[model samples]
Target: MTGLAVVGVADDTDGPVVHLVTADERARHCPDCGARARRSKDRRVTRPRDLSVGSRRPRLVWAKRRWRCDELTCRRRSFTESVPPVPPRKRLTTRLRAAAGAAVADQGRTVVQAARDYALSWPVVAGAFTSHARAVLPAQPEPVQALGIDEIRRGRPRWIPDEATGIWQTAVDRWHVGFVDLSGKQGLLGQVGGRTAQAVIAWLADRDQAWRDAVQYVAIDMCTIFKSAIRRVLPQATLVVDHFHLVQLANQTLTEVRRRVTVTHRGRRGRKGNREWELRNRLTRSAARMRGEHVDALLDELSNLPRVIGAPITVAWNAKEDLLDLLATARTGNRSAICCTGSTADAPTPTFPNCSA
Candidate 1:
């Protein structure tokens, strides 16, 4: 519509067709001789695909004039008029291709998905997205300070026959490790094939020495493979575990202790009406969310059970809550001016009854 004016509209079985012409009579000069083209040979109509109008498909019909370049010394013959929105000899309009590209890139749609939505082919949509990405995205990556490494589960494992040995082996690497720039504007760095040390090492090795040296701190889950790889590649970087994984480890430990205590004391699985079972959910609840009286009751009941039965559960629950409290401190201490319990490094180590600190 930038340089085109709609002359007429017609209905078709598939959708609507719009007849368009150039809005202005701009002077056209011969490309080689630089002489104004005054004579017109003939006119032809070309149809270009467009985005859907309303809910129906739309097509643009353009009547272009073929101008004969009358430059006697020039080697050019004739040329046709084209606009920015509708390029010459292109089946799809420029606006339509740009729209499809934006749909695939900005909207996070797959190539096939965008193709189906726009009634276009798969390769066309893919090309559109790739072009859009290259045009808008930066050529070089930004420097990173803190890096985070984590694994994501892909999907159900599949079995395929091995070429060398005819036996089919189950796909063991169902996980992909993703690296992220924690401190910079760049979000995700990249993802590698497997969750092994070799995959992590390979990705780290691909980066230049300056990139490895710039990475001062690395955050990762309790993944030994990642730990070993970073140690070998970026030895100067400090490896720290995220609070979410720390909380997960604490919860898992608490659950194991609770299950073991229940089986040993009650001689069966935990069920309703049992004091421990009833308090299961509340046991992990943060101290802020716990009701004072219910918590006091829990303490009174659990404290009375013999040391052999109640001691383990109480110790495990206390440890979990303590870690949660420490995590809360570290998380908020940087934001708030007031620091809770001081730095954990200088904090007193937890000492249990009759156990050396």
Candidate 2:
């Protein structure tokens, strides 16, 4: 007999069922009284589901041994024998339960899907996955140095009927703020309800003094509310604007310039056949990323247009390109590059000829 002794065997409609008992049996000690008992109290049998053994799902009917404490001086009662494969009051073996947990957590499948895959109940698989997650998750969060804050839209704008005023009131909150610990193994710390300074302040104030002191920097978008909140709560932490929002600002500037230039020259809104309108994306693209011949040809085309259309578009496009160059130079930590770029940008350029009637 291996760890399992086959007491009997039977054939079921699904597969072969085996009745098993513990193979290794020696002197048993009462857990509470520390007394060895040779006398038998009672016997019981349980059917526990096990993992598939060679393409056949094993159903085990386990005959268990129960013992009574022999010491009268100790406040002891009868206890049941524990087995390695199955725990008390559980219908699935440990290995089977672990398989269900792995199906849900590791494979990224839903609990319902895992239940169907493992031939177990939904609650059973879900509970096992939850327990596995709790056991594997870090006992305590690692310290965070740099934090990131951002907001995401939750749902559409909604209106609720107001009975007292007989009018519909618009819902207020449509955004959620996520706080992330950039320096920690787990990026997300928590999420708050609103994007207001008060909400952020309250969350930071809840942390202990040491945690607040440990924070070295905070990265956020160009939201004044978040900046103000960090200033009030974590005053020592350096506030840095995130890169995505900086790119968004550049895009907004390009869009405004394009719209203004379009309306000024074309005397109407931009549409097809408008050269400036068609090259909006090309105008925003970095010069290095664009094909040398194509970008030069496009700029040459702009220069050949009328002074009013060409001048404004050329200036804005040059500014966008120069901005990218300046950012790249700054990343390399070269002071000379910064000074040279600044000088080049400030230098005077040939002005557009007056086309006044």
Candidate 3:
């Protein structure tokens, strides 16, 4: 390539460089007008970085010429020759711009870093990154049938008071197979108001009717806002309450059991040291002991319950058993059985047998 002498050469400690000559046969035509006006009014030379020629860093030596138009009725009297393989009215070469774009888009590097690496201005680097991202980023996906909504706390900054804190909410649309972060905002739903029902509805409204009809099930916690949104948008879909929220209700009941047991035991005249400690220990061991394969441990613990706190212990034990029964009923795939346990009073009687599920 060095044998083809279309331009001059400059060698430095950093790299080998080549310059473009405007006096060549190919350089005579005006780039803007595409006219063969060889009479040059003015000339300017610019050196731009190019893709590496073999092992050596190559440079595009540009020779810009302002040539007078020979046509009488042309609006402009003169125009510059257009450079090949480079963007018009831009100094940086296409190869350098592309490298800068890759650095920003693929690597998440800042425009400042990209500019410094490519030896370009900040705006040039930013423009390249933006252009590349616009070209490559995937279009927003179609909506799914099922959706999940939840809120997350946003803590106060060190500069702000704790009471003035806010939160960033998010919603997820659960497809039968997988889930998508359909926060209704661009680029994966990372928005401040993303958790609102309005935002979710807005997102669904943008999708096609086929996508809307494809939804068969919508699973979410019992948030009224979310429920309202789901009913409004997916009237035909079945709304399934998330299992985790049901479990949480049962957990809350267990907490109430602890409180009630503590109160009832303290009312006894002689209950102070051993008796109180035993009751507290029993309450703590309830769920932990029953978890997974520790059912035998739980049974053994329940069997050895102290006679002094037997009544409260029996109440908690019965509640846990009822809860398990309810869970079994829900998981049996019978819609009628599940529907029968819907009311707060009828379902898990939040007292002696708190079947929370």
Candidate 4:
């Protein structure tokens, strides 16, 4: 931008195209000898990409000059004119790359989405994001009081031919593990290639001893790989099952129980006209969110069903509600549990199975 000057503007099918050229230069000095070059080598023009002007993208055409440093004693001979925004040999401007990176890293746009919006290749956008991440991330992650680790299916998996093995193999892993700073303002702390214990260990091993020691709790789903890795790396940190997974497990168990009861009593799966099917969604909803009349109606309907058909479902529903109630105490740092299994009407007593912090 410093050395660049707008020559003119023209209309295009997409938007306005801006023409740019280098400003009149003061005497060019040789890099090594500090002497000006009297002879010109050649001149060339390059087209570099920039950020979009509006809804549509504008084209950029730049005319640059190549200079010959005529100082005899100096080792440097020829160099190309460059500006801060549009550097030499770069196809995209600095601002373009920075904007692409920010779209993905800050605005939560995916790499493919940013690349499509910028009319660039996926690799270019991904490289820009890597640069942006390095600019933002610390050399060592800040010490976290509580850490959360989870697995995500990043994108559709691809299979490509493995040249050396002469066989087809997965090009990239679909599953990735993301680490988060649960106890502080920083959101996503790091990500790794796989959801394996080794991957988690590798990331944790990179941290300093003091940073690892500061982690008081590690919150994760019911994943043994993560649990094992935490035990090996940060043995002092307590393992806590996150609330989302607990609620998910409760819902899954309740659904399974309802399906089995429906088949046993009705001699078939739930259909649209079936009362059991009609109440399926209502049963999963939390009691606190339901109106008083709806709650009473739901209770009356379930109670009127055949005792054998309704009893098991009623137990499962009650268990889910009780578990939700226990989880409410988690904010106070209280560990509580209720038996979410078995048909016993009594609430489960507190018990934690394995040795944990």
Ranking by lDDT: 4, 1, 2, 3
Per-candidate TM-scores read: 0.65, 0.59, 0.47, 0.70
- lDDT by residue (84-160, candidate 3, tens digit) is 55545766667678888999989988989878766678988888887887777655454543444555544432232
lDDT string, candidate 2, 88-170, tens digits: 57888888888889888798899999888778998899889978877777654455777788888887657798999989976
Better TM-score candidate (1, 2)? 1
Provide the lowest-lDDT 10-residue window in model 2.
Answer: 348-357
lDDT of 4 by residue, 220-316 (tens): 8999999999999999988888888888899899999988988988889989977767888998888878899998998888888778777888899
Which segments of model 1 are wrong by more than 4 Å? Answer: 1-11, 16-50, 53-97, 104-116, 120-131, 156-174, 334-357
Question: Tens-digit lDDT track for model 1 on 80-186?
Answer: 77677876678888778888899988898888888999989988887887788778876645668788899999876677889999999766568899988777657
Worst 10 residues of 1 by lDDT: 348-357
Off by over 4 Å in 4: 2-44, 50-85, 99-126, 272-274, 332-357
How far out, in Å, is residue 296 in model 4? 3.7
Higher-lDDT candidate among 3 and 4? 4
Clashing pairs in 1: none
